[model samples]
Target: MSFEVDIGYASARGPREDNEDFAAVVRPAPHDEARGLIAAVADGVSSGGQGRLAAQTTVMSLVQDFHGVPETWDTTVALDRLISAQNAWLAGHNRRRSGEGTAMCTLTALVLRGHSYTLAHVGDTRAWLLRGGECIQLSQDHSFDHPDLRHALSRAIGLDDHVRVDYSQGELHRGDVFVLTTDGVHGVLRRRELAARAREGSAQAASEALVEAALKAGSRDNATALVIRVAGLAAGRLEDLLLRGRQLPVPPKLRVGDLLDGYVITAMLADNGVHRLYQARSVATQALVAIKALHEARASDPQERAMLAHEAWLGSRVARDGQAGLVRVHELEDPSAFYVVYDWHSGQTLEQLIEDGRRLDVSEVVDAGRAVLKPLGRLHRQGVIHRDIKPANLHRGDDGQWRLLDLGVAVSGREPEAARSLHAGTPSYINPEQWQPDDPVRADAGSDLYALGVTLYQALTGRLPYGEIEPYQLARFRRDPRAPSQVRPDVPIWLDHVLLKAVARDPKLRFETAEEFALALERGASRPLPAHGSTPLVARDPAVLWKIALVVSLLFNALLIVWLLFLPR
Candidate 1:
């Protein structure tokens, strides 16, 4: 949970009129540190006459905009987007100011995040690393080695509209040191000489020493160095941890007495052929926990492994980032095999409550609903869609707190390709739009909210508003979902209006945001909304309407015949 790092940067104009070299270390606030520590160095292409502006712009944009991207975006994707935009702007600016020399620079950026480091380079200002007393060059210069072409760069920012950037990544370790330098510094000092200075003292001191050494060595160009020392290794990406676990060979079927790491399996929670959930207790602390592992038969399946890995990351983030309303995912200490651990709460699923015929009243259902809305809103804003939202995926603790569960089928925009294609939410809870062949927006925040409405309606009425749909059936959403009050007479009219709007057949008719739905719930009867959940008699039940019409017609004809026959004409 600790993010320990040291960063320092130094720059000098040297013998030049302006210091075109720029170096910066952007250490975000503690809450934003998860995006990692960023250090960037840029050496301006001085021959172009606008190097200073280009260098400053390149590094400054990254420092300001990196964490502004959605957290669900992959690290590579986020960096690529920011760099690409900046490059395009600089390229366009060069055209507009044709007389002004083109703004161009060589960039090298480093991101130390989680337990790994991502490096992006273009016409490199060089990057080097020192670990365990060994120094290694981490980047290759884009300039030619031939003396005539040495001054010409094959690639650089603002050189052209399109730029091909080289990206690389590797595991990070404590005590690892990263050094970024412009040509003026590395061009004169030997690799070992540069490493010697970087190893001297603190990050700032080392950076200063590198620049001073470069100047002392008689380099004419502007010089700069950025040093980053890893004081501690943070948690690795969830995907990396799960991949390592996947490679460890799944442990055999565990019994009640089986011990994994320090936790002992206490009971089999559920076995659904694909996965096995078990209740486990920590031997040291005697704390209860839940473990989800692949079925032995599915040990070699790659798709399943990806799904479980993504689920772990998604659920873990949602629980950790928010105040409450979700079950927390726990990290095990050097587990023996692939599995996900969750902090177990003593509770029964909402599915169990409904199955037990414990019908929820208007107030109880509202409270249960408010508990889910907050977390649901958080997930949507984080760029995650919980495709599967149902009573079975909701848990109510003995302490009376409701928690949303099971993100196995959720989409976080970074899921594996195979996982992305699989539509795996429960059939009964799936919104009607996902079944439409023409509907473009299949499953999204609106879909989740629709499913939630169905769940609360079921909780109150003990029946699905649209009835239980079987898997693979082309759901003919020929009619709108029934109102809650219609199914359960005791349900209030205001409750009926809210739940109906949530499960409306036309997705646009449904609540646009979780906040909106929650507002209606909180307002209760005080500010009841009146839109449409009301369908015409014919659409609701055509056959029943026809039957009543036929009966009325027969009775009217009988009365006509009796009056004609009995009266003296």
Candidate 2:
């Protein structure tokens, strides 16, 4: 099955001299099926002189420019960029015609991609969804209630230098009806009436009926309604995600001066058994980039191929400033092989810095922790967890900026249940709960926090908090490990306390959020530190206590045997 939609739109001048409302639906071409369908409606501010122009320009730009966005970009990201650009253009146009008047409008757009629909809105133009005979508003009005003016827009395009658009996304299902309308239509019609009319007939009939009903109800402004019914939904497939990567052949081994597509390899950056990283320069752009390719042997494995593709896909979803951005895949010319390309930065791995015995100042350490945690926070907010967070996976740029890298094992909120149990992170860095045999290991914000604490501790002193935990070893956490202060006397007392609390044996004891942890490091510990040696020996070192018990048992047995012999038993 494939995505199919029935779309209809209607606009009327009502009592107004001219219609200031615009609406349209643009269906993707056969080759652009992945881009899916776009429907939008815009309402121009009646008081504005160029209301008609603003409304028409806003809707037209959204439907046309949306297609120009890179196919690899997430729908929300693409829509946001397009909307922002349109806003800038409209604002500039208004400034140029400042003597005449300014143009302003409210826009609401819905993009149906894959099995989901993303809603982008600004101003008072509204978006609604009708399912199971119920109508629900999907977009919030940017207007406010004023005593003098019944309804005044608080936000709108072309009204300011910056526009803040609201966005939301939800799964799509067959038979779902989406409605877009200007305030004139929705303000006059009741929710119950709107739902009933929208569900009664074909999309075109429904749209017309809704607008007529609004006019009959005495609407004084221009009325517009756009209706979209999901006729069918495509069954999700892996190929949809893998896309080009699935069709391309795995890249072969490369040496210096070897070329693939437009990139020429300069040197081998890393060569782990599973994959290889090469430092290369694009012949076309003359820009440096890092290309990662799976080893030929592992390329045949479907799981490995998916992981590599997913890493690139996930990298593209994150904002560049938040994580190491992926080079635009669409820019690469037709290639003989598949590989992921990343923008190269001159930097040293945190692991290498630690291994080199570079002394880090307290301020430097705190700054690094804050920098790394910021991206991790962004990932968490996006419902992504970086299962594998370690010093080796973090880079300290020559510009003194730290960025988190390697999304190969990152788990998203939409990940399947079976995939959640798969062990994907470093054994030493994984939290205790993740290693429990009976407990299901799922990546969450707390898990990332645990790893962040471990990372901070290792950076401060080149040592693991729980030592090197082997993959086969069953991890057990009975007590806290040695504090950072114990290893480095120069470590501040409060900072040590903060780190200890972060990597606490219990997830509940750890800082609840990355922001909290960053704040603790930025400003000294908010709470008092526990006294040293507060924990008992049995809890702190169970292995040592067990050894002592074994020795005592042997001595007692030896004495018992001597007594038995002397008593003539």
Candidate 3:
């Protein structure tokens, strides 16, 4: 169950193409003898935002970080780190160019170890396995249902507010060939054609052949392909794999007994960027608690330092406000060069709950809303706007309650200091007014209501209210989205109305405050639930329809056969 690999990449700008559609290769780091590999293909989103930059950054970062990937790394963590880093970089880059921001791009990255491989992807760029004279697709295309699909990518790096990557792991066998390519290749060359190319020659040759085929087939975009041939098995070198390359700046090592401020460091949560969340004891009462240390490097950076400070202050504000639905920030203390102290409840993030495949029943969504809206209402009353309100920030406690986290981007009206700072938040959940250049009233209550609407949409339909769109495309569809009931029929009508109003694109149309929104939702939930209607006319008796359709098909075929076999003869 182990093997070395042969890697090669081939790319071509097709007839109707201008920008290169394909970028793929394996970076060989001399320092890391771990034999790590990074194979990626990015299809630049053609509309705007330096798509090439998005592709190049994604590929370059993955290659640089591939050598140090953890053996026991969770795909979720890897994806989060990759996309989050890219986003911060993109955000900074975008600030320089008012309208020339980097364009989003589809991404597929693979890390290989002996015979095992890990894959992560967004959009339509894909990975495939060619074995036993057959080519099997290993990735699904994130595209809308359409005849041609075109350049519409469901997910792309640096495009949307957040990148949600689909990740998977698999075993590699000797003689098995893996192909990674942008849409130009698979969208043009058929699977049979790819399989034929895989059987023709070495990995390098096969890669070239596939790209050529895509060009011959009139692929109208940049075509890129990678061929990886499994050579043979070798020893598992997990540690060597991650530590061999260019030195990664390591944070100071922490120990269990080390005390900073009033909190005690327990253990390291992760390797990079100092994810040392500690179990600290209260100095006043000797009660155990949890705290997180920000990376010293990040703390030293001016922008990051400001964010850390803001996070600490916001945490304390929420706690002092006595909001039941937010993590209580007891006090701001420099546990280390960078850290925040908060009263921690043992609970899972909303993301963790979703990952656990736990569906939020209607009552659960309501109860969770009650928890979230109350704290939000409190913050609003204090003239605080939590710009980054989303599921990842929602923590579900053991007491069957939910809470908010990381209000670093929060805006407090009373603070002349905060009022001067510019807009900040995850774009997917942000209100339009928050993103505006000019300062509007920014009803803290109104913004919170909008986020609650989005949360409800996600809770019921398992999808975003406005669907996925690139950053540049945001302006095109700024209006309120179709109601939730249209997207998910089973959603209660009253709840749907409540959510729609909360997320209404027009502030004038949305609820006046979080409390008001909560009241409306509560009323919606209080009404008697309706039963699902009877089966539609088309579905009432499928058997009758099937029989009628079958008879028609049979008669048509019989007539065609008679024409060919008897009448024509």
Candidate 4:
């Protein structure tokens, strides 16, 4: 069963002249069923003369227009946008007819897509979830607590030009039950009573019993109730949640025995001053996973947290697209702290191999280059630039496959400013263009190729092309590096040419795409690339003119001495 559910709802005017309450469940055509089911209930504010219109229009717009929203939108974003638009229209209409009743209502909307549920709430409308024998309130009532203001709502649709709707989301289970109700039904009935009624029979019976019970309790207002019971959940796309505020709290620095969302930390992987890595194993499946979290000191910084969030999103995106060169990002379903999970692969990084004095021959260098560049090419095609691609960030798994690591600084265009604006990358491996005076931190395909070239060069010759560059230092690319063959005599001629072209001082001279550079390596000496000649002496040696001038003067003086000694003086 794919996302099967049972929905039932009931509404009545009770003692009022007519019901100003609305309840609906919208399911799209079978072909477009991935939009999922939308269940909502609204209570019109009596003070707003157009309360009925507000309640009806708000819920109707969402159910009717939701499927038409762009497919790229996350479920929460789509619902929030639709709700906000309806509020604006109601507010504008009220202003145009100032002497009449305003259109305002309290709303609670629920969207069940894939294996999760997203909610939008305002005013006193409520959403409840019954799971594991506990009935939990999923939405807060946006009303005042004072006796006189008890019925007064602090927030409602069309109450103001700007409406702040509370949005929430969580994992859905097979036997979970969800209920939506207007204030009329909830004000008179307690959670125990509601749960008891909701569990007595089928969803239809539960919905009818809640409304009838509320009315029998002497409620003066209209009563409404909508109930949904999940029978199954469907696997779906990764739904993105905005991490602006109310994100999970950052966990404190943990110990070996520490656990997060059922993952037990077995050992600490690394502890940079800003981020911490831990090796953990899932208690349920016993599968190993690596956890990345903000250091306790940096947990307070929002920018760092956003960067980590973006990294996780990017990693998941890459993994979902079936890019084998990246470590798989695992979803926690629900988590206790703000941390990222990745498949833990026991491996040594290329940097580690080099540090152990292991030198890679031409064949190994080519293999590594192709391994890193193939998926890198795919990532670039997807408009993502792996900003940091040094040897340390390239791990060679025990299975002998190389995987790119650390997308914390990747520029994916969809990421926040902190992920893109931050000048990030290993200085030694960064391309010359990234250090430009006019557009420093600029990155593109060529820059990635340049970094790959540097890594391959270092792996082949055990030395950086332009030598070691410290971070934050302005790197000069005026000097050309010696060919890889100069440092390692066994370096092949074809690879030497490719390295020089990849790390060329001018960006224009380097390979423009991973495919082009890859072709050069693939062809090898059989189809060696044409040499572009050496850098002009003036560019390679800025003091060449001065040296020439000094030499000329010395020669002229020596000739004068010889003439004076040989001829009459």
Candidate achieving the largest TM-score: 4
Model 1 residue 442 CA deviation in Å: 2.1
How many clashing pairs per prediction, in order?
Answer: 0, 0, 11, 0
- All candidates: CA RMSD (Å): 7.7, 18.0, 28.1, 5.0
Model 4 per-residue lDDT tens digits across residues 256-298: 9877889889999899899999999999999999999889898
Pairs that clash in candidate 2: none
Distance (Å) between predicted and true CA of 117, model 1?
A: 2.6
Number of the top lDDT candidate: 1
lDDT (0-100) at residue 542 of candidate 1?
44
C-alpha lDDT of residue 392 in model 2: 86
Ranking, lDDT, top scorer first:
1, 4, 2, 3
lDDT of 4 at 63: 88
Write the residue-wise lDDT of candidate 1 on 1-569 in tens digits. 57798887888999999889887888857776678888888988845578889999999998778878898887788889999999999999989987867889999999888767889999959999999889988999998788999968999998889888889877677789999999999989998899999988899999999999999999899989999998875555765555554665666789999999888999998989899999999999899999999898988888888888888877767788446888888755346687888988998899998888786667888999998998899899998999989998889999999888999888988888787788768888887656644553457899899899989988888878778787544444556766767777888888888988888776667899999999999998899989564666565444767889899999999999998999777
What TM-score does prediction 2 earn? 0.56
Cα lDDT tens digits, model 2, 35-81, are 78898899987454598898898889989988988866788898988
List the global CA lDDT of all models.
0.84, 0.80, 0.67, 0.83
lDDT of model 1 at residue 489?
82
User: By TM-score, is 2 or 3 better?
Assistant: 2
